[model samples]
Target: MNKLYQSYLGSFTGLRKEIWLLSLITLINRAGTMVIPFLSLYLTKSLDFSLEQVGWILSFFGLGSVTGSWIGGWLTDKIGHYRTMAISLIGSSLFFVLLQVPDTFWTICLGIYLVMCVADMFRPAVFVAISAYSKPQNRTRSVTLIRLAINLGFSAGPAVGGLIIAHIGYGGLFWVDGITCLIAGLLLLKLLHPKKSVEEVEAPITSSQSAFSDRSYLLFIFTMILFGFIFVQYFSTMPLFYAEVHQLDEFHIGLLMGLNGLIIFLFEMPLIKYLENTKLSALMNVILGFLLCGISFLLLNLTGWIGILIVGMLFLTIGEMIAFPFSNTFALSRSDGKKKGSYMALYSIAFSISHIFGHNSGMHLIGNFGFAFTWYIMLGLAIIGILLLLILRKKLEKETIEISR
Candidate 1:
């Protein structure tokens, strides 16, 4: 029952028009984001790509995302989120339509790859906009609300994608994706106002300068890459494991994701609410969450037990809710208004880069070592992340002492 978080429900009795508009933008973007869960399926069914081929192609998508994050941050510094998002939506929508065009495999691959790059560019703008609009007091609540919008889309997207694939076929799904972007672009255009001056901004990771660079931030980014690597499994590897090994249908696959979104929606606010303001305790919560998810990953071979698979996703969501927000808050708190977009953009790039490495590696591990061993890889990664976090804590403390002057 924090007042700002209460607004996430649109249940604060009176919501600010600005917040309402921001929420609508969230809903619009998320409704379309549902397309990502179906990207591999599209490649397999419509483009006739092998699993490894799909992974390679999706790696391009990850590259596009990494590039886009930087571009978005720069745009926020130069233009504004409103213009950046508008362009991204329209550009992505056009590419979404282009990807649907019947073409040879490489043609489709390159086209979609570029499409992802252009489409991806809008996110930093959106994140910067959110941060700019928020007062420091309610920043976490705003981030949480944005995440809730994403999960709401996640919950609905796969179920809808399943139905679309079942009926209209894959092309229809892309068409819908295109349309969703168009709608989201228009909505954002209608609702968002451009920030004229830069004083309102808060994070600055976008610059190539050494000022934002620190040993602690480096450790944090490395740990995040590992966290993101484990997560990439959900999209590229997990569904295949379930299907080839456990023989699950699309419905069950969709259900697992839906359950994840459900858990985050109902539980994330409460969980964060319970945490105290002690930085160490919050960091520990995040560490525990990632470690738990890493361990639960091994249970994935139990795809035979759909219930167990679902439970694993449940654990993963718990870890994500605990870790990601704190991570965002930590990074943003360390940033200034002029470079906020850049910092977020860089953070987004780290996450994107890991997907490129993670899935390609996951495919290899699963093929050679099997499910159990593949998860062991995740376990090792998680442990490395935790160790780095501990190192970062010590480094930061020492830095603080030195800077106290």
Candidate 2:
């Protein structure tokens, strides 16, 4: 038992202290991420807004995320990741406080846009910082560590958020969210040290001028969009499926969602550590991940039993464990360190696009066709995604070898 504990601890060895600190910062910020997840409910119940108004407000937030991601990348290259992150955290916190004031439709919509725009700008900076702080070999592990922290916080946030909502209401959620962001920003500002020289912080001339100019990265981005389009259905359609098909209550649905985080937290780091230098390439793992995700959904069609849902979710969780972190590592490997922000920003945009495309497409399919057809469509996309990914793997392997050389 002691040896097992020691080995688990050993997996975290050789990571820079900054990476651990960053993970803590992420945990602090994400733990209070109450407002966005429950935004629609708050709008409908507390502010007395209609469903249409809520949709427009949430849509504006999504637009803000897309815009913020691009601008964050641009700024990270020109400024430094540390400063960009500090600005994003502090600036976004102020906006969240302002978000509490507006009750009218246009006013609240504008507030949501501004809040998301500032809040989301931290993402690219965080990705760039992870690359900057860790050695190349340890990069994937570092990214996974932060993701683990995020999942932990995600598991905690809603439960704590529910309590606050019950007793203190919507305004309490905003206050807690804003305060936590402020604390995270202040801690990050005090700890993260960038080089003093301008030359050290800026991108080199040889780095790709823009992410769009690189054809291989563009193909990579396309693959990401395809996978993201399917994977994101977990957030949008999966819950509806659980409620409608399985006849699960809200508490049961929460338990199933919690299971994803629990499994990832327990297994992902060790799994990545085991796989790190193996014969299994990152590309193959990603393909397998997608395959498993599609299979998980298809498993739903095979049975009406709730146990099948748990089994399927376990597969989906494992797929996420393999795919998401390595995808970031692959992107970081392909990018010049100085221009990493831009490359990662493009990657982040794929997810943002997925948020819009995936949910709408799932709802449309389910509405027009049926639940079974929707799973079938996802299965078909996953198969196609695997084929494109095979082509992408060659370019990625070539690029990785070049980087090593």
Candidate lDDT scores, in order, read 0.73, 0.79
Candidate 1 segments whose C-alpha is farther than 4 A from its true place = 1-17, 195-212, 276-282, 301-304
lDDT of 1 by residue, 1-405 (tens): 677566544422232355557677767667666557877766776667777777777777787788887788788768877788899988888788778774666776687568778887877776766667776655565666677777877888778777777777777767777888898888877766654323364443454543147556666777888899998888878877767777876667777777777788777765665553445554576687788778678666545566788778877888888888777777666565336666778777778888678877887777778878888788788888888787777787888899997
**lDDT minimum window of 10 residues, candidate 1:** 7-16
Q: Give candidate 2 misplaced runs (Cα > 4 Å).
A: 39-58, 100-109, 166-171, 196-205, 247-251, 395-405
Candidate maximizing lDDT? 2
TM-score of 1: 0.90
RMSD of each: 3.3, 3.4
